[model samples]
Target: MKDSILRLKSRLIRTLKLENLLFKFLPNGIYVFNLHRIGDRHSCQFDRNIFSCGVDQFEQFLLLLKASFDVVDVATLSQILDEQQPINKRLAVITFDDGYKDCIDKAAPLLVKYQLPAAFFITTDFVGSERIPWWDEMAFLLRQSTGRVFKSLSTGQDINLQPNTIEKQIAQVIFTSKRDNNHTLVQILDDMREQFPQARAQLAQQSNSLFMNWQDIHQLKDMGMDIGSHAKTHNILARMSTEQQLHELTLSKQVLEQQLNQPIKYLAYPVGRYHCFDQHTLDNAKVAGYSLAFNNEKGKNRFISERYSINRYCFDEGDLSTLKLNCIVW
Candidate 1:
């Protein structure tokens, strides 16, 4: 009973951020970590939730990773698993998702400084395009809405935009509206734009260079980083038809290979939750010609069965130490 109380207290402390003792419970295996955006968290008006770390804090996290774990590349990790070796404690692999600009502008320089290898998964359609992600656009619209009550055109629901609750409002919008693709969402954004024209005008002035283009992707590849597919579009695979999943998987790989002149052996499922991918997605990944795939599930990769569902601990929003602890797997 005393042991249970102690464990409960530990969890309470970690959950409430009174202390960051979460890493104390880690298991022995490859600790694959994922990051999305890597710039100043409050710097963007879009999705602050996606910000991993600022430049200096990111460097501190890198130092922490170096001190705490044996960092390796994805290919090395695959080989280690293939050889049927014993799982090593804190065997780490760093990865970036969503092809965000900060992965190139901010994270890469520091990665070079530390001489660490990482994989980057790119959403092919948005690279070199003026398109902002669905979440970002949703945040922008929600935050930009002047009315106290947001009448959602897509869902035909009224969302209360309480004072100083833009974060909550964005969350509500995304929860109700998220889907496999933005086909229906395009009209929703347009409807929101009609309701809020000033925000739409303001959005046009923001840089379209938010995502890394083909040239910048080439530049990162030149830096000796591994490139893989996030998908053709950043859509949830399980929410898609089998044909759609196949198209997203195969076409993204084909495009990456064509552009980079190398075999694209890795894939990180779009959204990467258990519900985000089905068995169909896995079969299609094999048919798409990927050797391995990653998902942002919190667990240890202790065996070869996890090749398709490679688990990763991820950090998006928090202080450096907290983010570091959050990135450690159990």
Candidate 2:
């Protein structure tokens, strides 16, 4: 029954440690964390309990945010939110969306073994795509369909396909309701490629190399790591048009500042859901200059928030006390 109420609210927040007494009334500022894929959830092909988190639960969520927090960098939380300063500690930022290949083979070696400093947005046409992302090709054709049931020609709703985990929760509820409707997710993947034509040619012969290239994003910007822009084909910027959301936010920030020569500030919108970005996608991400922009709106971010819709907090592969009661209730 909802995994016994999330294992009794993760054993009452680890038996009342309550994240060190809710880390003393939180609210200092910035706590952005939105990861995707770490590793080895039984050799996950995709959707490992919603995009992944293993490698020792991401090194115990970076040792519980380095025993309290202050783990900065996105240019020091954009110069402490452009100088409204006053965060007397408890700052944290570490982001990652799309661009997977285990964010350069297993979360950049545990973010360089816990020195920690991440950003990594990038969907720039899946870096050097062979094409493995229409929601991991609809969870690899509903986990290699041997056929149990399947209907949803855009929501007629049959869906009883079970190869366990109720067929990855009905292929993540029909690929998150046709991923913000890119023409109804290309007409339901062209009617699931004419009804799974050889499971869409065995998901187009697999190996899309699971993302990350351009020399693994210039070796994650020579290991300091912070490369943004999750556009250029991650789509759903309020379903495009404002010149295709300013050409997917200025050509994925001018091709990641012309192949990582630098200066590609930030952005994380693609399916960063609150209707997937609007208000002309935040005035075309501040006329494509972009100092900061993120979504997936959950909570925690201040210095009067809203540098183009800040808010973030999403982690998967649950149960480190439900990721410490979602960082003490977001």
Candidate 3:
């Protein structure tokens, strides 16, 4: 009970901060992307359709941005940064988080059709695998396990959860994970795994089931997509000790840099919340030699520490107008 309340409080605070920051300024470019956008919710098709822009709503968005400013890629972004001059209006950047195969399948064609350049921030472990993300791992276990769902670390309350409610319940756990003091979320996920043996095995298999392979990354590169680091394991940095955080940041950069045979100067914070990182993490990134880094927090860029903690907004529900608004607002 105590922990649940605390988790709720922290989430409220984080949301308010994000809202406050996002509404305060104008963004140089609109940036948004995520792994899965298809609505079927059941079929995880590799390459079937690329309808993000073809839909009437997204089409109107594409037209609006096209009419507004020069839709540019990472190269142009880098150039603008180098030149230190503000580019014109409607400047937007399209980016997809995690190396989902569908980004290449579904999102890429739409981008190519529109002749827009974008970036793919990839988590190294999934670069060549089909792993369900860690967050999904927890959710899957909760969904597949029979009987009781979660226990409140503070109150020892065991909440009975239906399979359909698993996603929402797991999301609450993620919120719980935000509190520095709560390991209940982790404990619940861990115990749930042991509670269902067959389900655990299935989830373990599926956990390795949904990512872009190394060849896919190359293909994206060939498509003029900018590749960036998303940490090796995708653990929340603030949760790890200093050394662990350093290792995560450095090794991921090295792996991507070697695989791509180019500098990996950009980074996106794993699980990307402000509390998810610290000054030490930024310091470690510099020591690891990154020139710029991005966080998932939505906000406009201003003079900050070495551009390593650059802020970014997420595009959800395929809402192009909100996408454009956040782009301009950020």
Candidate 4:
């Protein structure tokens, strides 16, 4: 019954293009949207969920965003926030999460073509390294697991994996568990590798082509894109000790700043669900020299909102109607 109503609402919004009208009435704020990968979902092997959209969908989204709101980059948004400038028009900011090679190969080109700017949050370890980030590792292992299930490392909970559906979802829950610790992270990964030995071997071979090397990132910066830290290892900061959390923030920032010759002033929390960060993480971000921080949540950012907890929604839709519905509903 409820889903049917949502579907009808979605249909009306799509058919009538109600979001355009609604956008006019909404309070002025920054509608920050994030993407992970820009490509066909079916072609991905490790984590199909990460594929945000294909080339055409992304180009059209650029059009829709440009026509509707004042599209700005994260740096520009920060400047506005710092100055406490009242928004005269509704603003939108585009971002990409993770250091996927596709950011350079696919998304950047279109962004350049549209003459738009975007900020990319990169998981430092995944850049120029063959090691798969935790989420991909979790997804690949679950897919290769013969039982379609794996025991949660942090809590003895059993995680059910259903392909093309909940595989990555369950992994998100497992990887982002609040009780997660370094020892537990290592234990679960080692357990998965032992349980699914062949899977580890296979994923290792495919890892080389997965993320951007430093050269690719350098070129991306030269293309006029902004780069920010997504943490050194993409761990849930709230789950870590203060020292560990601080280390994650500082190390990632230092490395990025040194490599890119730019101040790393922003952070996009890894597995940035609501529970993924805490007060301590927020404090540590300031200490680490980040002027602004963002998380993966659904909502827009008002100018007076917390700078350390800016909200961003995933905008990985293939259809314009679906995209409109998502942004409206979120």
Candidate 5:
């Protein structure tokens, strides 16, 4: 009953705000939507890593946006931010990460309905292949294991794991796994594969969590969405050697640019954290000639590496209120 009341209040509040009934004074605005799909709640495959913005909710969000503000691409928003143009109303930009196939199947038509432009960042490794994301392998291993106590290969020490709850397992894996331990990540996954050969085989045959294929990417490019690089294999950059980092960043950009037959222009760091990028990585990005870069931080951009460190909001429930609030604040 309490939850029902809270939802009702949330709906009421959103209805009032949709009509411009609250916070009418704030000026410059930039809203970024993290386009994605919500997969199985308990699936070991990127259960939360890759997003899951369902089609129906996405349509509703677009409907609300159509009724409210002018939609623009990152390029236009950058020009406004660069020129310091005085804008009379809120401005919004729609963006998707991980380059899900749904963006083409589910999202593209809606963009046409409202004539909105968006940006999609693609992780080149997963394109044209069936390789599950590394993180998903880890999640699957942890979930499939029976024991509550497990020791990571690198640490060689036992840590309590709560296999019963997905949230707790996710939190444990993230907190306990060191970002630099690539070898350990691989070994742990191998261990899981040996123990669950059938599961591994099933994963082998399963298509990558529904990514936008080359054809879909081409169609989206023709439809006016900005396509950018999201690293080769979505590895954490800062932990890698400078050369390794350069290869990850530059190769993805080169491949995408060649395919699209246009300047790729933008780069989104894999894992997109402050710690994930260093001076060497930034230098490589600049050398690669990217016009802009985006981090997954959710807020307004204000002068900190705005050229290479733009902020973007991740999608949760694809609720209109959250979308509107994110734009108003950004």
Candidate 6:
């Protein structure tokens, strides 16, 4: 039923060309779009559909954005917002979170082809570690497990796992961990590792080429790409103490600047959900010498928008219509 409603709405919007009329009403401001990965979805080891934008779809979206608005870089947008300059035309800025190998191999070429500039936020720990992220490791373990039933050590619930039920289990555990402010997710993953000892080796082997190295980052910087900090360990800032948060923010900026020999001025909070960062996190970002900080909150950024909590819109292939609606509405 829900799918039917969405398809109908998409057809209506496309057939009636409501996006054209709605575009006129959209306020002129910086529309920042957050992207994650760009490549073959079928080749991915984890949940690709949620985070990936296929090459073809990404090209289409880029063309549409370029035709409808002026594509600007982070520096240009920051200057415009700082100066309180009037926006005579609509503008859009592109950003990629999580420094994946595909960003350098696939996404960069497309950006160069379009002559569009973008920022790539890097998690300091992952750049040279050659390890899959904790979340991806969790998904991999679940997908590899042969057990049909296992008790959750953190939630004390009996989860029935099957081919169809693995994703739900992963999602529920992650949601609970984020909500509780406890490291229950880590405990759950630990339990899974104990049950499937061989999974760790498999994951390590698979994750060997998932992240970019320092040389790739240096090449990106030389290619005129903006390099920003995505924190050291990608920890939730709000859940950490002030000192830990400061360490994550400061260390990442220092390391990136030292390695790339360029000043890192932007930050995208890890996870970037509402609860992932707080007032203290923003204050620490300022102290860390970051000029701009971004969150994953949905909306456009006005001239007077908060520099420390700038909002961004995240979209995938299935969200083109929703993205258009958000561009006009928010």
- Number of clashes in every candidate structure? 0, 0, 11, 0, 6, 0
Looking at model 3, residue 250 earns an lDDT score of 90
The alpha-carbon deviation from the true structure for residue 159 of candidate 6, after best TM-score superposition, in angstroms, is 2.6
lDDT of 4 by residue, 1-330 (tens): 865876787677778868767655666778888888888876566676677889888888899889878888888998998888888778888988888988999999988998899999988888887777665676677777645566766666776666565655554755554346545566667877786778888876763568999999999899888899999988677878999999999999999999999898999998788778999998999999999999888776666468898888787556566555666765
* Consecutive 10-residue window with the lowest summed lDDT within model 1: 321-330
Top TM-score prediction, candidate number: 6
**lDDT tens digits by residue: candidate 3, 1-330:** 864765565466455555334433444443434333433333422221222332344445555556655677766666667677664444566566666666766667766788777788888987776665546666566666636755645346676767566556655655665563556345655665666667778755643556788888888888888888888887788878889988988999899989889888777787677888998899888888877777777654543335667666665555554554555433
Whole-model lDDT per candidate: 0.80, 0.76, 0.64, 0.80, 0.69, 0.81
RMSD (Cα, Å) for all candidates, in order, is 3.7, 17.5, 6.7, 3.8, 5.8, 3.8
lDDT of 2 by residue, 1-330 (tens): 865775676577778768666655676767788888777765665545556577787888888888777798788888877987887666888899988778888888888988888988988888877766666666667666745576766656787667656546655655566453535676676776676678788767766577888999899889998899988888577866788898888988999899887789888898687887789998889898998888976667656457888887887764555554665665
What tens digits encode model 5's per-residue C-alpha lDDT throughout 1-330?
A: 864765575577676665244434435555555655543333435545455456677777777656665778878876776787766556667777777666787888888877888888999987866666666666665655546566665456665555456556654565445354545456656765675566567666765655777888999999988898998988778878999988998899999989989988788887676777877888888888887787776665433345777777776755555755554444
Models 1 onward score TM values of 0.87, 0.33, 0.77, 0.85, 0.79, 0.89
Which portions of model 2 show Cα errors greater than 4 Å? Answer: 1-12, 15-30, 35-87, 92-96, 99-120, 127-130, 142-197, 202-254, 258-262, 265-313, 317-330
In TM-score terms, candidate 5 sits at 0.79
Candidate 5, residue 215: CA error in Å?
A: 0.9
Q: What lDDT, from 0 to 1, does candidate 6 have?
A: 0.81
TM-score of 6: 0.89
Cα miss at 93, model 1 (Å)?
0.6
C-alpha positional error of residue 13 in candidate 1 after TM-score superposition, expressed in Å: 5.0
User: What lDDT is reached at residue 232 by model 2?
Assistant: 89
* Ten-residue stretch with the least lDDT total in model 5: 38-47
lDDT of 6 at 221: 88
